[model samples]
Target: MDMVQSNQLEIRHISPEVRKLIKMYADVNNCTQSEMLERMILEWDSQQSQSERPPGDEDE
Candidate 1:
């Protein structure tokens, strides 16, 4: 269990409502709060890069 292999992070606070929602969803899916957040960030990282845009971008 080395520190380098761990998924460490720092997150800012959110409203109570959002916190409750996150907890509820995590409970239903049987995952920790941090785990759910990590999954979301990974999914975002999987998106296409800026240079790989589709056609019809010459006007910009």
Candidate 2:
């Protein structure tokens, strides 16, 4: 897990579509906006990590 200490997520830079999706998902999950975004970012990171691994190189 990452050790990010910052509490700021500048929403102004996010595309309108993504911003709306975030809001909708956050409301559905009953969590704070930042919390939802953090989960999303973490999920993306995990997916990327898995895809970037070389075949047959699953050592952790």
Candidate 3:
């Protein structure tokens, strides 16, 4: 399967500790910082979608 191309994302005002944690996580996971962030975003989106669904509507 072909991977989709990602556009650039620029964020500012993050604390140094958070930046260090992200870097550490990326290192442990063997992925770039951008990839780690993308994964985190996708997971967060999935969680949000699941929570937004009505109860007992799991089949949808």
Candidate 4:
């Protein structure tokens, strides 16, 4: 996948627990925080689209 040029996203309201989880996940996966976030967002988007599909439309 190609990287898109975009403005930075500054999240200022995350909880400490969530921050720790993100850091831990990034460490375990050996990826930077930004990479982890992008991967997670893409996976979530894919899951959302799949859930929105009709019962018999999965084979398309």
Candidate 5:
């Protein structure tokens, strides 16, 4: 048997109208919805970790 680690994900179904809206955003950004979503999550994570720094560190 083999096992693989995975990031937990929540999935939901949305109406066609909502999907169209999401598609518009994705197209404007030149990215797929999943790509956009992943980017968003990464951005949020980076923002949350931005305050963590060692002493003597200064913005360059």
Candidate 6:
């Protein structure tokens, strides 16, 4: 795999409780910690993008 195709993502400043939650969810979901974080970030981005669109902006 090319390095450019898979970039690193550094997440900082999270509380210990959040860190433990991530680990627990990752284990329950059968994915790595990084994968769980990616899922969370992507879901948040999708929701924000939908909310930011103008009224009646439904996709065809």
Q: Highest TM-score: which candidate?
A: 2
Q: Could you give the candidate ranking by lDDT, starting with the highest?
A: 2, 6, 3, 4, 1, 5
Candidate 3, which segments miss by more than 4 Å at Cα?
Answer: 1-8
Instruction: Give, for candidate 2, the lowest lDDT window spanning 10 residues.
Output: 1-10
Cα lDDT, model 1, residue 6 = 49
Off by over 4 Å in 4: 1-8
Top lDDT: which candidate number?
A: 2
Residue 4, model 5: lDDT of 12
Model 2: per-residue Cα lDDT over 1-60, one tens digit each: 332324233665788998889889999999866778888889999999989989988665
**How much is the lDDT of residue 30 in candidate 4?**
100
What is the TM-score (0 to 1) of candidate 2?
A: 0.76
lDDT of 3 by residue, 1-60 (tens): 212134124323456787678779989999877677667778889999989999989776
**Model 5 worst lDDT window (10 residues):** 2-11
In the predicted model 3, the residue pairs found to clash are: none
- Tell me the lDDT of candidate 5: 0.58
lDDT per model vs. reference: 0.62, 0.77, 0.69, 0.67, 0.58, 0.73
Candidate 1 TM-score versus the reference: 0.52
lDDT of 3 at 42: 83
Task: Mark the regions of model 5 whose C-alpha exceeds 4 Å error after superposition.
Answer: 1-22, 52-60
**For residues 1-60, could you state the per-residue lDDT of candidate 6 as single tens digits?**
432223224434566798789889989999877777778877889999989999876865
lDDT winner, 2 or 6: 2
Residue pairs that clash (backbone atoms under 3 angstroms), model 6 = none
Error of 1 at 45 (Å): 3.7
Can you write out model 5's per-residue Cα lDDT over 1-60, one digit (the tens) per residue? 111111113213556685577668779999776555556567778977776766567755
